[model samples]
Target: MTIKEQYVAAKQAYANWGIDVDAALETLKKVPISIHCWQGDDIGGFEVNKSELSGGIDITGNYPGKATTPEELRMDLEKALSLIPGKHRVNLHAIYAETNGEAVERDQLEPKHFENWLNWAKENGLGLDFNPTLFSHEKAADGLTLSHPNEEIREFWINHCIASRKIGEYFGRELGNPCLTNIWIPDGYKDIPSDRLTPRKRLKESLDRIFTAEVDETCNWDAVESKVFGIGSESYVVGSHEFYLGYALKNNKICLVDTGHYHPTETVSNKISSMLLYSDKLALHVSRPVRWDSDHVVILDDELREIALEIVRNDALNQVIIGLDFFDASINRVAAWTIGTRNMIKALLYALLVPNDHLKELQEKGDFTERLALMEEFKTYPFGAIWDYYCEKMNVPVKERWLTLVKEYEHDVLAKR
Candidate 1:
């Protein structure tokens, strides 16, 4: 049977379960996932003094034809977006700013530094997100940033974050969407630190100073991310989950969660409901971690599906901001973006296709047996047919057809770079 014919069959199957396939597709289309810009250049931004990556963040492998300039990065992103279905946003690091061949300090950044990105995003009909580059800098050499003991270094990082909020606000004002500015610092010690509270206190003070100049929430929203441990911070991290959760609750800011930022066994999916109870909203940096926070390319794994299911089950699509955060240089950069993003969409689509109401009724009635059975049964539903239909509607390649486009672009465009 043809794709549409299969979709019709799947639609009938779902109808028997009281699930509206059409509504699920519509809801999935409306959800916008933010694609990280670092994937194109392997986290090497367009900075004049691009220092070696430090502070617990590192990208492995060296695939050829990585984007070297702001224009090239955007060009690659445009190609990746073409293969992925649905409208999406682009997450940018402050280091990606185009300073027009001039040296620009992180603290001295303004909206004008990203005028090119703003124009590009406007033309593409994409929303923008921002992050302060708190790592891989001269000041961050000690693996400390906002929580640094040096007062001068802490002030410098604080100024950078404050400036990032203004830039985020500018993007939101221009694009008519609220830009999510997230702060994640790799401030911890490789070995044990004697006084952890002192650094955390300094970090809190710095954050307070940064948020003193409040911007309109309509234009830009603030989020603080926490990490259990990082490469050089295995001993202790100041911005643990407990720290940011308290800070977010007290300051009324959004709590950003990175899936790989937690322990190996702990899942961010389980924390959704708990975070929703406290914070007004949540932000997510979705990435796969094999053993540690490796930032591997995301796939449609169990954890990915669970996270998507939680978001949909809680009906928090609007309140939660979802974005991709991974950098794998082992494969084609554009293809990596397309694959990870398509998989993310697939997970959400799978969650949307489930007979959530029916399953809920079973759980409420204490019919655990049927709830378990139905959950397993829904896993084999004809999700691919509906996914193909959605991709067709979105004017993107279905299945593996996107790989062909990426290969062609690599030979014709990226190869030259």
Candidate 2:
């Protein structure tokens, strides 16, 4: 059957469950997933005086044809965006700043260094998000940044985060959208610590100082991310989930959750509803973790669907800031992005096609049998057909056709690099 014919049949099937496939597609189109720029270059941002990847952060797989310059990274991102079915935002780290060959310190980074990025974003009609890079720097060599014992080291990172918020506000003001400036520090002890309270206290004080900076809250929203541990800091991580959760609640900041930041058994999907109850807004870093926090590419797995379901069923689409956070240099960097991002959208589409109200009613009424049967049955429904039709409608390649485009780009543009 033709694409339209398949879509019509699928739409009718969903209609039987009181689902509106067209409406779901429309909603999906409007939702913007913040694509991380670090994926293009494997988290290797263009800094003049760049330090090696530290703070337990590591990127494996030496894929050829990686983006080496800021222009090239932006170009690769544009190429990937062409294949994805919806409009999206670009997430950038502080190290991605363009300083015209000058060794600009992290604390001194300004919006002027990102003029080209702003112009490019304006031309492409994409919103921008910011992150304060705290992992790979000399000041953080001891695997502690804001939580460091020394006053000067903590002060430098505080200034860097404050500067990052200003850049975030600048992007939001120019792009006509609020920018999410998320702060994730890799501060912890490799072994057991004699006193954990002191480091956490220092970290809390640094955060208070950073947020005290005068900036338009409407333009730039602040977020604090917590990690269980990292390569170096395995025994104890200062910015644990409880630490940031309380800080965010008290400071009225967004608590950014990374999928791979928790224990292996713990899931971010299960936490979304609870978090939403306490905070007016939340941010997500959707990543795939295999056993450890490996930062694998996202897939359309059970957890991903549950994550999407929580966002859709709760009507928190606008309240939750969705961002991708995986960097797999083993595969084609562009294709890795295309696969992960497309799967995230696919998961959302699958969730939208669910008979959520009925399922909830079944759970509430204690009708487990029917709920299980229906949920299992819907897994085999005409989800792919609806997705393909949406892709066609959005003017992107349908199904595996996009892979051919990626190969061509690899052969032409990337191969030359």
Candidate 3:
């Protein structure tokens, strides 16, 4: 049978086993995935579709960064969105902050900026994730000198809140918005652990203030409170622990788990299970094995990609939003993201083929051993036929484009090492 036929057959089998095949397919289709395309020398302006492989490496050579005029950015985004299908979104960091990383010195979401971004995205049918860091994760531990014990960090964080509100307002003015802000803070320790309690307290305080501001004051307040996620640089990083999440829960925040940020030994499925158990807000960061570094590249079995999908099937968690959190220095950022997303889709399909009855029976009996065994079974189960099937049905051209992307960029990425 053709690949599409195999996919139909496998999906049919899943449906017969009481799985919501249509829902699964829809969720698989609409997972909000994007890459971090920062303003840099490699990519000066924006080449949205072409950068799907290497994250738009050097595509905008000699072009101004965010220093470009608002009209310029709007024009860049307009052209970029027209090339890519669907409402393509990006996770961009705010360049406005005086933090260590590069930031836009321009006003935070000036009226002109918002009007242009809004009109262009609306006209062209696109979206922006606007993932910004409040207290730069890179500086949280070592840059204690830049902040105060209580007052300074609060001030910096609240400033982020103000900036966030302004940006959201600017965007919402154009499109009726959902999820006005995307926050991923590295507010954890790196070395010589500080008073863990203090960090949690400060973070909670900061979030409480932000939430109040967003709900009580902001114009388009449809922010997904649960999409707020944290990552610790190390395993013991403050935000990586349970207490930080507990405090977030107290203030109505959810956990977003990045696959690479967990301790190297932590499997994706286990993390998903733990995060699901403890939190109502669920978001996922998908990336591949980086050996030592986090957010390396995207590979299906590089770590626990298969099992992560199984957790989705077993838990049947539908409210979760899966997004791409890929950062690459040497290779093209967009290419890595596109390949990573496709790999994720392939893994999702494999998870779908695993008989739902088998998974349900194990869960119903409280059979941890049996459930894990079935999950492992699904992890290695062969569904190439099904994968090929969906590729044809969706006209995704998985093999050719995937191979071309991998072949062209994989060597470049490896050579940079």
Candidate 4:
């Protein structure tokens, strides 16, 4: 059957539940998912004196056709963007700065180093986001930054974060959109620590100094992300969720929640509604974590749909900032981004097609039986029909057709590389 014909039938099914499929599609088009740049090159950013990937982060498998240069990475990203629906943003780490073969230290970085990225973003009409690389560096060799015992080491990271915020401000001003400069540090102990308060206190002081540098809020906003544990810091992590949650609330900064940064039983979907109660805005790194904090490619799973439902049902579409964060060297990198991003958008589409208001009313009236039945029945509804129509309307390849183009690019462009 034609895509439009399928959509027409699906629209009527949702309409019976008082759901407006057309309005839902319009809302979905405006949600921009920030695609992480590190996925294209396995987080190996272009730097003159690059350090080994450290701080408990690991990327397995040696995928062929990994982009080796700044231009190539950007080219690969553009390819992935074309396959995904909706206008989106690109997320960058500090190490991705281009300095023309110059050995610019982290603290010495400026906006000029990212001029190429800014120009590419402008020409393509995409928004930009930023993050300070607090891991995989000499200063963080001990697996601690900001919370380091040595004053000199902590000072270096503080300056680097300050420099990164200024660069984020530049992107916001030039692009006419506020850039989210997020900070995620890996500062923890491999074994149980004798004292935790000391490190957290030092970390708090470092953040205060970094924010004191004074960048205009109109151009840039700040966010703090926390992790439960990592490779070396299994026993303890300085930037725990509670630590950053309190800090963000007191400091008036956005608190970022990485889906993979929680415990095995803990779920990010459950925390979204509560976080929204205290703050007007929140940021997310929507990633699939397998077992531990292993950054796996996202899929349309139960948790992903619940997360999307929380955002759409609560009417927090503009309140929550969504971004993708996962890297796998086993598959095609471009295809990895396309699949992960498409699934995220697909989850949002699925949630939008649900009868959220009706479900809530049923719960309010204590009609648990009907609520459970209706939700289950909606699962078998025609969600795929609407998604296929969205792809056709957005002018992207429908269904699995995008993989064909990826194969052609692999043989023609990536094979030579």
lDDT of 3 by residue, 1-417 (tens): 665566667666556656665565565555444534442123233221121212111132231122233344343333323222234455444542222233442223333433444555577655544544444232243423112365765566566655666676556555555433555454444345646566656655665666666442233332322211223333234344365456545655545556665555666566566666666556666665354334555677734455545555655445455666554445544344455666666666566666666767788989989888866665554466556555555555546455564454335532232
* Candidate 1 per-residue lDDT over residues 118-183, each given as its tens digit: 999999999999999999999999899998878999999999999999999999999999999999
Candidate 1 CA-lDDT value = 0.93
lDDT of 2 by residue, 1-417 (tens): 999999999899999989988899999999999999999998889899999999888899988899999999999999999999999999999999999899999999999988899999999989999999998899999898998889998889999999999999999998889999999999999999899999899999999999999999889999999999878888999999999999999999999999999999999999999999999999999999998889999999999999999999998998999999999988999999999999999999999999999999999999999999999999999999999999999999999999999999999999999
TM-score of each: 0.99, 0.99, 0.68, 0.99
Count the clashes in each prediction.
Answer: 0, 1, 22, 0
> Which candidate do you rate higher for TM-score, 3 or 4?
4
Give the 10-residue window scoring lowest on summed lDDT in candidate 1. Answer: 352-361
**Which ranges of candidate 3 are over 4 A from the true structure?**
1-27, 38-88, 96-120, 135-147, 150-153, 169-174, 187-190, 216-238, 289-293, 302-307, 314-317, 362-382, 402-417
Clashing pairs in 4: none
Better of 1 and 4 by lDDT: 4
Residue 122 in model 1: lDDT: 93
Candidate 4 regions exceeding 4 Å error are none
Per-residue CA lDDT of candidate 4, range 149-228, in tens?
A: 99999888999999999999999999999999999999999999999999999999999999999998999999999999
By lDDT, the better pick of 2 and 3 is 2
Query: Runs in model 1 with CA error above 4 Å?
Result: none
